[model samples]
Target: MERRSNKADKFKYLQPVDRAAIALMLVLIVLIGLLIWNGDRTAPRVRNFSWQNQQVGAEDTSFTLNFNRPMDHASVEANLQIDPLLPGKFSWAGRRMAYTLTAPVFYGTNYKVQLQGAKDKSKTESGKENEKLIDPFYGQFSTRDRAFVYIGVEPQEKGRLILYNVTQQKKTVLTPADMAVNDFKIYPEGRKILFSAADWLSQKPGVFEQQLYTVTTGINPLSPGKPETKPEAAGKINLVLDSKNFQNMKFDLSPDGQAIIVQRVNRNKPGEFGLWVIKPGAPPQPLENQPGGDFLITADSGAVAVAQGQGIAILPMTPKAKPLDFLAQYAKVFSFSKDGASAAMLKFNTNYTRSLFLVTNQGVQKELFKTTGSILDAQFDPRSDTLYCLITRLQKGEQDQDQEQPLLATVDLKKAKMTPILALPNQRDIQMSLSQDGLALLFDQLVTEKKLPKTGALTTNDGQAIVNSLLWLLPITPPTEGSKTQQQQPQQLPLPGFRPSWLP
Candidate 1:
């Protein structure tokens, strides 16, 4: 006991520098303890904050942003901002904030929304603040494309009906503006476009009615003051067969380019329209006499399929073979298969209920799924045997007389099912034409109001003002599956005009 007491006393007599060093070590330990206590008492860190349910062209809109923990509603709403900054008219549903845009967006316009000063509600006792979270979100929705086909409208001017490539970002006007264009078709080799145009001898009315014109793919348009190089202009489009009203007149060039099958209207008599096989440079020849309406040429060998009132018939390419009765009494043909072995037809019951059908060999027919509304038009992809159709449905408060919104759907024969290709909400009057490869779709989406109650009463507004008709190319192969559905988005091609007919 005496020796221990002596040792403790000796340590107490240590130097001032040693005492100071011990004091410093004790202070450092206390500081470390304080930091650990502060960290433990703080709130959980917030992370993975993001938005959801975001789309460009949707009418009903909602957004969902996540937080590390349940957030204070006022704080979250205060941080959310949409620009052209929207006014305070939104409602919050739990963690989601929803609001309808008061103003309709213009076509081809881009929009943005910003979130600022977003943070967790939890705070430290020392009054220190956490890192403020912030981000900006952007999206673009385009207005409906225009309808380029001048159906039911007369071409008044003698200028070239230049079919510009509107699908490209850099606008390339493809057709030359030398002569007036009548009904024209792109050549089987897409390099050359074949159209009928008329040279206007005078500025008199009806002088520029019909003319034949052709322009190669890469030909340059003649500029002012440049030497006038006469582009190869074919002669007038001679009236092969004239009709009183050429409603729904359709024409298809054969694969060999030797003949064109046309749905010609015989104006001299009622119900006189019929299918005619005509040589482009030679005289016209008549095919099987059928009620002339819409017709499609087979993708494989140019066999003609004509749609009558209630049924469809396929005229064989061989001169000796008789026309094959392919469809049933209830089915009508709209499109043909690649090999012309099958056709997409609409099946109707006695009650006028309609369903889609794919007619095949062995007299087999499969019904496409029942649609939500009436199916207006259907097209078959000769390459893939896929059927594309346009469906229309009336909106709320829209009567049977009102124009309906059009939707596009694609039917996969392998799956024996249908999938919606596009849901056009703003579109009023819609018309679509598909390319041969099944990759491109030319559509005229009308935004103007259509004349209703056609009792021959002449009530008129500003004539059908076209918005913008665009051609979009969508890939059909590699069917979209699972999470790869994003690849199904249509690739827009630059086209001068909307209606694009693929070459053979």
Candidate 2:
């Protein structure tokens, strides 16, 4: 009956090495089973989420999230929440995800977020999946604090630098009574303003005596509801530099707030224009061979883009001075991206047509749009993939033959779609700027002053023959294609000025 051939009898016939191998296999299988069970019990967690509830630059910021485990793609999207409800799209890569804001968030505003009901891709022993519920992930950051614009209101404010608080919508004048600030830029920290102004002490009619000056902007002087004392009136204005032989025409502040690039004209030798690099507490040095026109400082502060007779050349700020010719074929560069990463170049062809091209950092030119009329100005939007452009389009109506009307258009860089935002019929010297948070757009639309009978020229009320500008603050709300032009009119703030610029 073979009663002795039971389990023990079979094991006794096996070798010691075979028994050891079987035990090792059992241990490996048990370990794997434990790991699977632990994984199923633990829900995915957001290791670090960025770009939420904080002040960011006017440039469009993309949200980045890192996860501890694999997440369900659909579940994560559905569970994500942003409040006050910013519109954005999500891009996922396994445990990492990015969310790009469709429109830039308003400056100095609190933004909140919540991510709930996100489930892991794995299942548990009872066939239950782990669901992660993240509440109020990363807190917010603030954008730049305030912006400065010049107001040339005569008898009172003539080329006066006005600081407008984005959060409170408050205004404070920073220049003295007779300083006559021509052009200015806010420091990155929003504390001080570097401005070029006509020196009242050395004033000579028709002889242009401008000097560099700086005024504090970060002081809080509400003064218990005293209407906020003017910074200039508070003795905050101080002379930074008294020019002896050069006049600072246009200047750009570095994004890092370390240096300044100025387009200076030699007073002794008229028409001799050059570039000056300045660091605070140190004397400025002239950069040789730099053509004087509109200039911009690169983000790294290692180079500057100067509009020269030949074209825009990026001159490196080094001992060995060699410039890289950029966009030499274009007639003008309407604007450069914040970091000098891209530029809006205009090409004037022999056929009498002008086209606007978006030049990237890789030296690739992506033709944005072209027209037979004209492209007055084009600026890259700091926040998102958008552009604020001023163009004159020829009228196609029957009664308006050969008539062209200037219009402010917003172009979405991703879609190449242009939408008219404002009609600039008689708005001359139209200077436009976007706030650091990308939520507000400020533009000065000046109507030419009536020509004097004797002078036969338009003159500013400041006793100078210059165009007086009206400052308009437009809340950037991109409308659809079929929207009426009037619907896009921005909220016109009471601040009027020229050469409007936001703090970094």
Number of the predicted model whose TM-score against the real structure is largest: 2
Estimate, for each residue in 1-504, the C-alpha lDDT of model 1 and write its tens digit: 999999999889989999899999999999888976664333323333222212122112233344444445665577666554433355655444455443222222334555555655444568775444433433322322211222221132113333333333322243443443445565532335555444334222322233233455432333222354555432222334333244224566665456666655544453665666666576555564545355666656457666666666667644344666655464456766544667677766666567787777657778876654677778876434467888776666445464556788878776778887687645544556765434456664333345341221111122343334444555544233342223355665544233344332
Against the hidden reference, what TM-scores do the models get? 0.51, 0.70
Residues 1-504 of candidate 2: C-alpha lDDT, one tens digit per residue = 376667778888889999999999999999889986676445467887565434465554587888887878887899787767677889988899889876666655566666777776776567676455443354444444555545555456655777776667777777777676666777654567777777444443344567787788754322111243444332277876667878766678777677877777787797787777788687887787746466777666678776776567788754238886665766676777776778787787779878788888887888787787788788776656778898887766667567667788877776777787678754335567776655567777665545441222223324344555567777755444565223445665566556677665
CA lDDT, candidate 1, residue 502: 35
Top-lDDT structure, candidate number = 2
Model 1 collision count:
23
lDDT of 1 at 220: 31
